[model samples]
Target: MFGPQVFLRLFVRINQDLWPWQVLAVVAAIGIPVLLFRQKRFERRLAVGLMAVAWAVSGYGFLVGYFGPINWPAVWFGWAFVAQGVLLAAAMFSGGVREAALPSGRFVALWLIVVCGLPWLAVAESGQWQALALFGIAPGTTAAAGALIVAVITGPWRWLYLPLLVLWSLFSAAMFWVLQAWWLLVAPMATLFLVGAGSWLSPRTAQSPD
Candidate 1:
């Protein structure tokens, strides 16, 4: 009876020269968000499938010793934001789909400002303000926060969240060189796909008694 941790450790050892945490970080990033929001069984399965793919990719990277430690958590979360984008986009375009009410423009703007601003504050408090001067704040944190704010204000335009999730994933990948943030590459992609598929296949509208 082997567990994920046991397998993960084994993979790490085999990879030797490479950092295995990156792989784990990415998988967890994607897996956690999907698990958080997946309301349908089929969608859960799809998300799981995507995670499996991510794991396999990480394993391959590990075996080849092509690993490094970066801000993988930030990267993964960034992809989660992309998933949110996709969901929002879908909600906007799909005809049969019931669009959730958009958030007030003021609310969205205010939330976006907060989302973008808080990371700077966090870094400043940590004496990492100089780091921000160089790399800026982590985009994943800001994007994810903004998307969640939007979702909350909009009252669950679940379908519109996908693009944000994709954006998160892409951002994470782009930052791979900066922090070797591999999690950004894998996690959000898997989770967002799961959430998206679930949202897509769900009944168009909830029914009410006549």
Candidate 2:
């Protein structure tokens, strides 16, 4: 949907414009998951709800507002992100994630690493503080965060929806790589790794009586 030059510029520019959001996204990324691990009554709503906001903001704020000015297809992507946000928000009430397996200690750790690792990736790849692609502010981080959420939560559409997220993860990684954002490559890999790990471990956990 975008040329490499345009995509790179989009990442750099949006990050600069939304610098404060980096702190907020990092805070939410770390806090919300911990609450989810506790399996708090309202944690599910809060966690996924945070993710929905990320998606929507990335759609409207980044894609529609920023990227659209440079690339025409970004407007369509903006709407797609908005739609994805709605679906993600709706997932909170579907009883799917609620019924899905609770995260194992390892699963929780993996998820945390994926979320918390963003800054390192940003500094290493972009080599500029202002270009940090913080979650909710940039598309790649947003998609990775969303995939991480789906990985731990269980539901009827769990399998159905995961591939789409993973696909986005790949797409995001490719986009990052186009700009030589190497550390960002770990995003999709880490996400898919967790997804695979969760898939393998969950069945056994579910079948085990404990």
Candidate with maximal lDDT: 2
Report every candidate's CA lDDT: 0.37, 0.68
Per-candidate TM equals 0.30, 0.77
lDDT of 1 by residue, 1-210 (tens): 332233234333433433443455445443533442446544433433333333333323422222223224433443443443345344334432323332234433433343344334323333433322010113333333333322322234543444554654565445433444333333344334444434433434457888
- Highest TM-score, which number? 2
Alpha-carbon RMSD of each model:
15.1, 3.4
Residue 109 C-alpha lDDT in model 2: 73
Name the weakest run of 10 consecutive residues (lDDT summed) in model 1.
Answer: 129-138
Clash list (residue pairs), candidate 2 = none
Give the per-residue lDDT of model 2 (tens digit) for 66-170: 878876766777778887887777776676555344546766676666566754565665456656667787766677666656654566656655755666666
**Which parts of model 2 have CA positions greater than 4 angstroms off?**
1-6, 99-101, 173-183, 198-210
**TM-score of model 2 (CA atoms):** 0.77
Q: Estimate candidate 2's alpha-carbon lDDT, on a 0 to 1 scale.
A: 0.68
Judged by whole-model lDDT over C-alpha atoms, candidate 1 comes out at 0.37
